[model samples]
Target: MMRVSLSGARGLMLISTLLLSTTAFAAPDATKIANSVVASLQAKGGTKASFDSAAANGDDVVITNLKISNEGSEATVPSVVIASPVERTPGGFTAKSIAFDAGKVVDGDQTISWKTGISNDAIVPDPSEMHSTAKITPFSHFEIAGISVVNKSAPDPVTVDSVTFDLGNVIDGAPNDGKLAISGINVPGSVLKSAGQGASTLTDLGYDSLLLNIGVDGGYDSAKNALTINGITVDGKDIGKLAIGGTFGGLPREKLQNADQLKELAPTATLEVASIRYDDAGLTNRLLDMQAKQLGAKREDLVAMVPGFLPLAFSQVNITDEAFKTQVSDAVSAFLKDPKSLSIKFAPTAPVLLMDVSKAAMVNPNGVISLLGVGVSANN
Candidate 1:
């Protein structure tokens, strides 16, 4: 058990601000929007909520499944139906209602279900261990109601409702026996129209839908000193598809005598990128550019310098039908190999996409576009 102490009241304030800001939206009925958002999360099939018995000192904190259902058209959309979970915990509450939009036929249906589990560690746990487990079913006949801003050029505007997450789950007694999952994810279609940014950065690129699925299996065994992750799967029409398998083990606190002992006690897990599709050219370029900028180089400078330094750039610069696949592959490969990581002590006003330039620059065959710096950190 790894206990993560709450920094203080200030920490709570910071977390509250983050959650409030991330979920904030401009809607006539804030309650309706909130309900709809939670419903959407349940329908996506990856929502999870968990609790740790050790953290509360064996306190009976009930965990519940979340179920959401939607019906009707854009105009007269009916209220969302939310079902409470079977397990109960402290501060547990549930509500349901219909939000009416006059003269609009927002016809759609969605259903979601979730499950709960408890942690078994004795040490202090992270704040994420407060709940047991939650699983959301799926949303049917769903649609967006607002326009998304992707780029300067206005394309066909469409409504969007996206659910984002930052989750951590503890399995049994092992602290590292944890899992994280994200779903109900969406990207604006407009961002897909741009060529420069999407091509260079993954964060800037837009997606029709994205899902991250991860899990931990096996019972706690201090003697074996091992755990396993099922795998990671990413699915969506806009971003292509990807699947990877890997293992994680490195108990820095535990002292091992030799490499062989370490290998037997803590082995390396393989994370394989099974398949990738790069059909969204404009979005890909934007992502690449965004990534380059994060490394301290201007997008235009990288693009202009590429021809002089990298042979691949000369052949891959233009977004053409013939070169689209190769270009997208190269960009994605670059992103995966050189993902950004950093620690900052400042604040900013915009979204930040961090990068690991050293790793990325090494993988670039052309070497023309070297990563001057790595990682992105933003205050916004």
Candidate 2:
């Protein structure tokens, strides 16, 4: 697993390959380019003869029967591609604005692009373990926008406004040699609606924008050998905000391809929650609403029901301070009604395995939670 665990690559590769099949063809006229595209597909082992056709406006080709997905995930689409005639570049052809569904991507105007980078060409040994054969192929620049993907397995569609990744070409391809600049990964709260139904125990989260270098100016840093996912922030409009960062070290490619192996590896990770701020009243109200939604009860009814449920939960963790619990409960209750701000920060003194934190949370949550901080930031 590489830093950031770009897990969805396989799915993206499947659809992108349908578009890349045309990379081999280029022409001055759109019609000529269309002809080349049709011919290119025809030569491949098979492109459904009935499913392939091309039309032209001026310099771009309108293609069909590419048999790819209109949604980013599914394979069901009358994929209409408008490819610019492949103009020669210093290194490779330009993958210009490609339109499908309701989005257009001006991927990049740079050199040295490979079809394999956009397409996944790896074999999956275990369905449960999400891992790909470790490979690194950096693009000069890549961008996509307004892509609404309905992952059928998931409860809702994942809509991405845009995502751009720029892995700077380095003199050497060492693990720490190059820096990858990325941003514009905006996931709206609508994507969280269904998933949050289960998370209703927390707060009803809303639209939040995450920027890595997006926050800081022109952010890019040397690569790391560990799998690191940082710059995580969750915002709840009426509640508060949460930010987290983490890096999992000692992860080799082969080890990550298995589910059971993750627990063993968690011990080598350094993770942190920079801030968790909440308005007590707003949070309690939201949690009540969430509990109501999850239990299908009226919010008023949950007012009575939740308190009864809290004892068992607190007792399971052996929290028996009536005075302290009352203060905590009262704070939560007061916060729920009128809202009072509460902020928490965790910074571990040294690296600790994620496994230790998980175990510690069961006993001493505050002490264990602090153990998540790593020795360095993901962008360092």
Identify the candidate with maximal TM-score. Answer: 2
Regions more than 4 Å wrong, model 1: 1-190, 200-227, 235-240, 251-380
lDDT of 1: 0.32
lDDT of each: 0.32, 0.43
TM-score of each model, in listed order:
0.25, 0.44
Most accurate candidate by lDDT: 2
lDDT of 1 at 247: 29
Tell me the tens digit of each residue's lDDT in model 1 across 231-325. 44454544433434332233221433234355543232221111111223143455556668678987656655543444464456532333433
Put down candidate 2 lDDT per residue, 1-380, tens digits, no spaces. Answer: 65544667776887788666654432335444444434433443333323366676555556664442222322322554554545332212233445444322221221111111121111111212212332333234444444454544445444444444444333342122222333333333444444555443232432242222231112223343355444444444444444444454556544454565756666555442243444332455556666788899998776655545766876787756565456456544444444455444456665555677778877775455335431211110
lDDT of 2: 0.43
Candidate 1 lDDT score at position 125? 18
